[model samples]
Structures are given as structure tokens and as C-alpha cells.
Target: MIKTLDSVSNHEHRQIIEKTGYKVETLRIWKTGILKHSISNPSNEQLETFAMNVDAVLEKSNLHIDSKNEIRANCTSHFLNERRRTSKQGKETKENIKVVNNIKKKIRDNNLTVVKADKGSCMVILDRNLYINKVEEFMNENGFVKLDNNPTSRLINKVKNFRVSKEFEDKFGKYKNLIPSNPKIPKLYGLPKLHMDNIPIRPIVSLINTPVYKISKFLSDKLKDLTEFKPTYSIKNSGQLAESLKNLQIRRVLN
Candidate 1:
């Protein structure tokens, strides 16, 4: 039930619309609230325009939009829709999961392949035969051989059974941080770099899934602190490097 009070601010108007559904089932609510976002110069036309913006936002969010105003405050009406209590997330049934898995299996069975383009900004799809041919050609040109067996299991076992000396532990902390638990095989994918003279396949090996990833990360972080403000090792470009070199004090360094 909307009590027609004086004009309220736009923010207050949206709050009511968001709470109240197409029909206000609760008749017990008699409280009216106003928030001072700005000076409330109540106008009916402004309310209508504000409601249109609310509709756009709600629509974009995949939310229910109440086109008609059922609640009134002051002389103006504000749009309100009931919250969808039925809408839930992560409530998929077992049958739904099985169906989804089956669909995925079917897709994989057809020998479809995917790789991240620009590190997951998007994916580029190509013919399976063409992709394999390109990768094989690159490997052959580089004199790389394809291994007969998977080596991920062997690597994981080796890391798990590894031992560290006391002196090493004292300098670099514990052994646990240096080893990855349940490490997946490192993945390699190539991106067709278009900006190059010849669009070369820029081979990338995903280090995140490697057995020594944790050790690499720990060592990298420890070593990074030493290089924070070094004079010669500038990464920002040639201009920044020149500026940094100009500011270096060579006499003080020798002394």
C-alpha cells in the first residue's frame, strides 16, 4: 500500500520499487522512508524518467522489471517489483549435471579442441586437422620429439618424495612451500601472433600447473625484493631506461 506523501528523492523511489512486487502482498507495511541524496525537488516527470533508467538497469541484470507503478509517495509514483525468492544459484539437480556431462563428453568425442587467445580474453577455434598440422610442423622445425608416455605422475611422485637439507630450509623457509600438491601436467599452447613479420606460433607453456610451480613462485618472490629499485634493470621501455640511467650515481656506487 502506497501512502501518497510529498516528493521523495530518486534513490528512495527505487528502493520501494525493488521491494514491492507487481502486487504488494504485504499490507502490514505502513512505514515510508526518504534518503537525502540531494535536494528533493519532487516532479512527476522526473520520477517517470528515473523509473525508465531503473527499468534499463534491472533488464540488463536479468531481473524482473515492473513497467507499471503500484506504489506512490507524494504525488509521484515509483516502480516496484517483488523479489524472486524462487530464483536460486547452485541448485542444479543430479539429473541436470549428468545431462551437462553427457553433452561435454559428446563434444570431446568429436575431437574438438580449444585454446585461450590473448590469455583468456577470448577463444579462437580452428579445424582440428589444421591445428594439429601447425603444431606438428612447428615441433618438427624445432627438432622436438613427442614422448610416448605421460610424465606428470612421475614428476608428482618425485617432488612428494624429495628431501631438503636443514641449511637450505633455514635460508629459504620450509620444504612444503617449495612443492605443489596434486600438481597437474604443464600445458603448452601456441598463439598465432599476427603483428610479427610472419605470423609465428608463439609457444607458451603454462607454468601454473607444473610440479615445481610452487618452488619457482617462492624463489621468484624472494628474488624480486632484491631487484625493486636497481639502476640498470629497467623494464618500462627504452625511453624510461634512458631516463633512469641518466639519474644513476656511478661514483657513489664504486665508493
Candidate 2:
């Protein structure tokens, strides 16, 4: 019985059962383990009937046996792997949705301008005046004197000069600010090490000409009529941007 089954393939088994008078649902149930028996466990008479039916079907279809076997094997492996990948992605997507929802809630509650949230990080847009005001308020509440003569102007200047600094020392480094020992007064000041250009208060017009930006803009334009979609701030490349747009469409359709 094992040798007889060893000669047959899954597609052949399906075709044989399909050719018989039994419904395709029965064959499907058997394949899904709902049925206690499989096509391989058929009686001798059933096997004979299956064989005759498969032969007739194959003859009518004029399918090459070798080609059929090769194609079936390749497709089976390809589809099975695809199924597994899709299942794994579905689980990851569910987790990501939860995270994104939480982030959105926080943003709403805090009135923060968070543009997007994905796997590792989120993108936020800050208003310069609002941030400066908050800093000034904190400084006033803490009784910290501004380093320069003009508090608001000096605070803005410091923020403008703030640079991305890396540290290499545990105690003291170039980026570390020095405080006077036994100081007569507490002072609020910007770091001396930060000497970079001010953060852009407006959009960089030059970026519109870049390939990545163009691609993202094109996709957004194309999908404008279908749904409202925009690229997330964290998207670095055209492919990632496109995927975000695609997800937007899927979400709209699902909703």
C-alpha cells in the first residue's frame, strides 16, 4: 500500500478524487484532516476507479506528465513559502497597529505634532516658538538666570546654535558645559560646544527636486483621488514611501 501511494503525487490524488462522483468538498475535507481517511488509504476498488478517472482526465487535458510534475512541485513549494511569509507578516502587522494606535493616542492627549510612528521610532514636528516658550517657562519657574543679557533672544540663539554632539568621556568632554564651583548665582545657558546652524523653520525647497521626494510626491498625487494619502516622515526611500501609500489604500478599502 505504501509503494502504491509512493508512486502518486498530491495533485494526482486531487485529480483522482475530483474525477470520482464524490464532491470536491469531500476531497478538501480529507486534505484538511476533517475526514478520517485520505485518498492514499482508499480500497483496492476505489484505487482502480481513481486510476481510470485520472487517466481519462489526463488524456482529455493532454498534459505532459513530466512537465506537470515539475510545475506542481515548484508551485507547491513557492506557494507554501509565500503562505508562511504572509502569515508571519500578518502577526507583525497586528502588533504594529497596536503600537501605532497607542502612539496616536499619546500624541492626541499631549497635543504633540507627531507625524508618523512605525517599528523602531516616531517622527515629530515641533513648533519653534512653542518649544522656546516652554523652555522659558521652565527656566522662570526654576529661577535660572539666562546666560546672555537678553533672555528670550539669547534662548532662541542657543536653540538655533544647538548641534548634534557625540560624547566620548565620562567626566569631561568638548560637548560638556562647564559650571563654576561655589557660584554666586545659578545661570541658565546654552551649551558652548553646540555651534551648528539653526534648525530650518520652513520646508527645504531644494528637496523637492530630489529623486526620493519626487517619487513620494508622484505616488501621493496619483492616489489623491482614490484616497487621502501622504508619505510618513520616517520613509527614507521611494520603495518605503510607496509601501506606505499602498497601506493607506488598503486601510481605506478595508474601512
Candidate 3:
């Protein structure tokens, strides 16, 4: 439904237009210029990530969250088993086994980068170099070197317990990006809102880290609405206090 595309911004937009047979014509008007990002896919991963990032900010408004134990239980009964069982339903039992084997193959192919102990409270993966840097930065900023305890101590206990009352999925209900670079960003419909996002450091070196904020659909949708093109311009021009708070929070987490 878009007409002449204006000056488009970002690589994803350009990629979409290129792949989708959309054309763009950039024009300058007076002293100002306008952009028109036209596309057939209309949806993008970066936009999804942005919505998630903004939603984390909105979740702070609720001042409620779940504890670590509840988060772990929800992760087990809901996420892990549910995915396995759901995959088994639509396909032959052997096909489901094949799917699970492929997943295992992927895990093993990565040199078993992630390893876990059943009884241990912490999940440890092979350390990646780049992730080390980010984690170090996070530590320098927050005076903490470990993420294992942070989830249980800092955030898990701080938030109130919530349940997966209903099934949830992403905006398009298509799993575009299941993992994130920022752990604080909320999952689509998963419980234990807070998680450890990873960064690749090297062939095997990666840093696993956590986010300070935990978010849900209510916050995600609100942030999406608030961050559409109009709100961004308004925030840039008039939202000094809000911007400062945002900067502060980012600094607190990332340093």
C-alpha cells in the first residue's frame, strides 16, 4: 500500500525492498528530506528486536516479576517439554526423533559449546572470547563478574511470580529470531521473562549474559505502539527526561 518510497533507513529496509520487488525514489524537499521505506515483507527482524528492546523499558512500569524457582519450573514444564511434545504431534514419531536429532546435531556441531549439570543451579557453556568482553563490561559497570548468581539473586527474587496462563507467540507468530543478543528482552510467550542472551566471541568463545528487565506482551505491544515513527521523532525532540532515564538504565546494565 506504500507509494513512492522515500529515503529509506537501515540495511534491513533496503534488503526487504530489494527482495520484494519494491522500488524507491528519494526526493529532497526544501531544507528537509523525507524517507519512504517501502517493502513487500513489511516485517523485519530488527524491527522485532527494537520492539523487544523498548518493551523492556515499559515492563519497569508494572513493578512485578517472578522468582528464580518459578522461572526454572516454568522453563522446564512449559518451554522445553512443550516444544518437544508439540513437534511430535504434527509429524510421525520417527520424524520427531529426526527433528530432535537434528537439534542434537546442531548442539554437538558447536563443539558442545553449551554444557549443563542437572543438579547445579548454574548453566555453563564453553566460554567465547567476545562474550567475555561484554560480560566483563557488564561487570565493570555493575561490580559483578558472574551472571549465574545474578538471575537468582538480583532479578529472580525481585520480581513477582507469574504463570503462562495462555499460549504466546511473536507478532507474526513466525519464529524469526528465537535468541537475542540482549537477555533482558522478553520472549514471545515464554515464561521466566528474564534470560541470558549470548554474544559470539570466536569459534567457541561466547559470552552469556543477562538483562535487568523482564518483559511480557503487554509491555511489548505498548512499546511497539509508543515507538512507531511518530513517537521516535517526538522523543528525540522533547523527551529529555525519558531519554536520560533510558541512557542511565543502559549504562547501568552495559557500562
Candidate 4:
């Protein structure tokens, strides 16, 4: 397996793997069905120490819940600092996760879902069925209807046929390079607005791989060049906005 990994062409391969390494021994001992522990790349001495520590905890410490929790040794618990920690640990632990246990029953009883925060690496707990109903309500309010069947394949064929048609080719031949070779069906999804009181789901249409992607991109680029003349109103960032505000003037209207 090491030899096979070394022979893998895409990598700047290691010439020879280290002998008596913990990782190598782990792979050598690995089974087909069983997954290996991610962080427990323990050497012989570390393994022995870990076993002794576990024995110490079980013998010296009470098997009671609070005592068991109190007996959490760094050596006994693998990757004490890293195993269950996430990048958003500070934010989550401080604001969200601390109260999660208290609300667990309330969530389960209400049949709510615990989904991810939209803009940040946090959690947003909301009822998924209720969320779906609200989304459906919004869609209905905006005159959007549910389709009876998926029209993705049919839509693709239609677009492809139109692209190859004589009239279409004649009209759009100059922009052939801008046309996408392969197009994907567009998807619509919603992100939870956690900051809002009602926690509305903000609708977003993902268009990167869709049929209109290339044409829309081209049009946007063209429009940008045309609209760049209005520099005062077309503020993009905070810096530009600030600069625009600084130069603002309200002229008195001549009656």
C-alpha cells in the first residue's frame, strides 16, 4: 500500500516511508470494513501510557457521572484540544452551544431542525416543516407554482437544439465563444436570516452552471462598461460609499 501510494504520479511522492512509524502500523493493521481512528496515531509508549491512564481513571476515580466527567485526562481523551473542536468554537460555545442542551427537548417536541447559519459559521435552529410552509407561502405570494414533474432533461434538450438551429446560429454566431459547452439545471435554495426577528429564509437562485450563466455573465460585463459613467451613485464598497457621501451636496431648488 505504501509502495502504491509512493507510485501515485500526481503527488510529489515520498521515496521511502519511515520504518516502525505509528501511521504505517495503523494502515498495516487496518481492516476492510472498520474505519481507523483519525487522531490516534499513538506509538507503543503512548499506547501503553493511554491504557494505564484509563485504568487509573476507572480504579482511582468514581464511576459516577460527575466524577467521570471530572476525571477527563488529556492523555486518556485522544486529541483533547482538537477532536471535537471546530473553527467557530469560540462563537458557538459562547452564544449558541451553551444553551443547546436546555433547548434540546423544546426542539424535539416542536419537531424543529437545527440547520447551519447562512452568512456565518453558526447554527440556526428552526422547524424545517414550518420553514418549508413559510417558503411555500412566499413562493405562492410571488406567483411561483410547484411543477408536477422535473423538466431539467427536457429543458437541456430544448436549449441545445436552439443553440444548433440555423436562425439561432445566424443571430448568435458572433458570441459562440461565450456559449457554454455544458449547462446544468439551475437550483433554488434558501438561507436562514438569523439576525431577523422572524428568521425569514432568504431565497437565492444558484446560476453558476446553468444555461444562462455565460450569456448573463457576458451581458453583465457589457452593462458594467455602459453604466460606469455614473460613478457617484454606483458605489460598490464602504470606502466608495464614504467617498461619495463626503462629496455629497444638496443644492437649493430655484422656485
Model 4, 44-161: lDDT tens digits are: 5866786677767677755886566555554456544443454345444444333434345545776765544455544444555866785776687889977898887786666556
Which candidate gets the maximum lDDT versus the true structure? 4
| Candidate 3 C-alpha lDDT tens digits along 28-130 | 1101222232222213465456556655664655534555445445544654465566455535444435544553464455543332212222223332333
Residue-wise C-alpha lDDT for candidate 2, range 127-167, written one tens digit per residue = 33443554465556767663555354444344345554455
List runs of model 2 lying over 4 Å from the truth.
1-63, 115-200, 203-255
Q: State how far residue 147 of model 3 sits from its true place (Å).
A: 6.1
Q: Per-candidate RMSD vs. true structure? A: 21.7, 29.5, 26.9, 22.4
* Model 1, residue pairs in steric clash: 5-74, 17-79, 17-80, 21-81, 21-82
Kindly give the stretch of ten consecutive residues in candidate 1 with the minimal lDDT sum: 13-22
For model 1, the superposed segments whose C-alpha errors exceed 4 Å read 1-123, 165-173, 195-199, 226-255
Q: Which of the two candidates, 1 or 2, achieves a greater TM-score against the reference? A: 1
Model 3 scores what on Cα lDDT?
0.36
Stretches of model 3 off by over 4 angstroms after superposition: 1-144, 147-151, 161-217, 227-255
Candidate 1 per-residue C-alpha lDDT over 1-255 given as tens digits, one digit per residue, 9 for 90 to 100 = 322112212212122211122224222111121122232243558657876775566556643333323222312322221112212212323334444455345336655454443332333333455557767778889988889999888888888889999998998788977776668887777874333433346687888958989878877777778777454544668888788679787765554
Better of 3 and 4 by lDDT: 4
Q: Tell me how candidate 2 scores on lDDT.
A: 0.40
lDDT of each: 0.51, 0.40, 0.36, 0.55
What candidate 4 gets wrong by more than 4 Å, as runs, is 1-123, 161-182, 193-198, 226-234, 246-255
Ranking by TM-score: 1, 4, 2, 3
